[model samples]
Target: MAVVASLTDRKSVQPGIQSLVDLVSGGMEQVNQIILSKAGSNVELIPEIAKHLISSGGKRLRPMLTLACADMFGYQGDGHVTLAASVEFMHTATLLHDDVVDESDMRRGKLAARKLWGNQASVLVGDYLLGQAFKMMVDVGSLEALRILSEASAIIAEGEVMQLGAAKDIATTEAQYLKVIEAKTAALFAAAAEVGPVVAGESAEMKKAARSYGMELGLAFQLVDDALDYGGSSADLGKDVGDDFREGKITLPVVFAIQRGDDKDKAFWKRCLETDGIEDGDLDHAIELMSRYDAIADTVERARSYGDSALKALDRLPAGAHQTALAEAVAFCIARVS
Candidate 1:
């Protein structure tokens, strides 16, 4: 992954994004425990898989974004808690479904839900979580919240389907890839951030700004993640390098590498990516070709551009420490690949 640029002492309006992070640090435990407790039941496989995946640690960044956005809007209502958890459940549901779609065996350095509990179980449990998330949203009694999450979920599904079709298609373009990432990853982040303003009854403009910020941040984050999959440490990232390549998933780096490579290189990449499995040294060669073409730098540059855009979206929001932290986090997402 790219190294997050130095953010210490950086100027920011809302450092509350970071402060919110600190505030919500221990709060997620309660959410997770509650999920596990309530999920306990007749279906042993569901609990097993849910427990395994949930226990595998995550930063709970989605919920943090939701809470921070609410707080930034001066919301003091306790309903933010349920909204936060709902966002997390939505996130976790996507993870379960994503792993199944990707046929991924590992997540957070542990067995993925599909691997541990079987694909059928993983898919069903993912659905269950989505239902639970909606139920919580309904409990919050906000039509805006329902609209945000529902629209996001639809976008996410569309993105996933688009990506699935895009994979291994040598004709895939950079613009198309960006669209896929925007739908698959950024939509959820945008929803997570936007829903907070919705819950807090912030002005339409503020909600739009928050949504745009998160959408840009999510794009930056996923672009960097793709770059890292092509050239990153499994130990550092908690996921294997070349995962995108291994799965025949055509990410930005691969698209760039193909576009930049010579005819022979292009042909070779085509064969490797289309085949069921890549041969020894194909990954290394791909990496070398990507390097020669500066694919990583290309991805980084794009991520940085989006990071700047995300910070720009913050301009319309209320000034506070949390906003600064959110901006810093955006910078960190892009820099993390360095």
Candidate 2:
């Protein structure tokens, strides 16, 4: 709770980013309430499972992007708040299911939903959250919004599926890896950013700009996430290091390493994924391979490129405190380690 309250107090953020943070903070309260109410009183079990992930302090970046995108388009209607919350619910639902699928133990610095509630409860509550999310979107009464959200959800599912299949496959290329990230990670970001412009009735060009900004930023975000999995401080990242390797999940860093790795390193990389439950030393070895290939540095540069492209997408937004904040926010995508 203190974390949530303190997000707005980061002095390093520009005013525009602060405004978006404030709007997102206001919108998330309604979204949480809506989720609990929709789960019903009798199903206290399910609500508790949902709350495990919901109450954990995520940055609420997706919903914040939605609100900021809406704000950029001069939207004053309250409908955006409902939609913003809806987007967050959709995101949380995915996280719940992802924890179950990945058999993950930690999220947001605590036990995962599946760990506390069991897989059955976690999966069911995840389903409930998805249903409630769509209903909230319906309450907003925009077919356009529905279509965008539905497409995003579908793409996200595809991305998950693609990643699942790619897991344990040594041949998974960087291009295929990028595709998976685009679907699983970038799709929701693009949709969240685009929703505001569509609802506010902005020009097609501006809507496209919003979409571009989000897609590029989202890509950068995921790349950084992969990089952090290998090199970041566990306390800062809120998850154990090398979870990706432990899960045998093929991310950009690994793919790049495999592509660029030397013969001895390549063979070692191959063996690492082939074995179940990576040894602690294997993580150090993996990092070494990535470092030698310069994959981590390359990944960071790629993230920076996307962050730059995200800033470019906002070129048309009128000069104001809000637009400046949005630009700073896009940069923060690469800056934040967590």
> Which number leads on lDDT?
1
Residue range 1-338, candidate 2, lDDT tens digits: 01111122345433235555764565666655665566564777876777767777877888878877887667878777778788888898899889889999998899988888898888888888788889988999989989999899999999999999988888998899999999999999999988888888888887788888789889988999989999787775778988888888888888899888768877777777856746658888899888888888888878877777776676665456556667667656666653
Q: For model 1, how does the per-residue alpha-carbon lDDT over 1-338 read when each residue is reduced to its tens digit?
A: 12222233244322223555675565555566656665565877767777777778876788888877887777878667787788888888889999999999789887787876788899998888888888888888999899999999999999999999998887789999999999999999999999888889989999999999899989988998988887788865667787778889999998998888889988888898876558898889989998999998899888878877787787667776567567667766766676
Best by TM-score: 1
Clashes of each: 22, 2
lDDT of 2 at 194: 88
Off by over 4 Å in 1: 1-20, 26-30
Off by over 4 Å in 2: 1-19, 23-36, 39-41
Q: Over the full model, what C-alpha lDDT does candidate 1 score relative to the true structure?
A: 0.81
Q: TM-score of each candidate?
A: 0.92, 0.91
lDDT of 2 at 45: 89
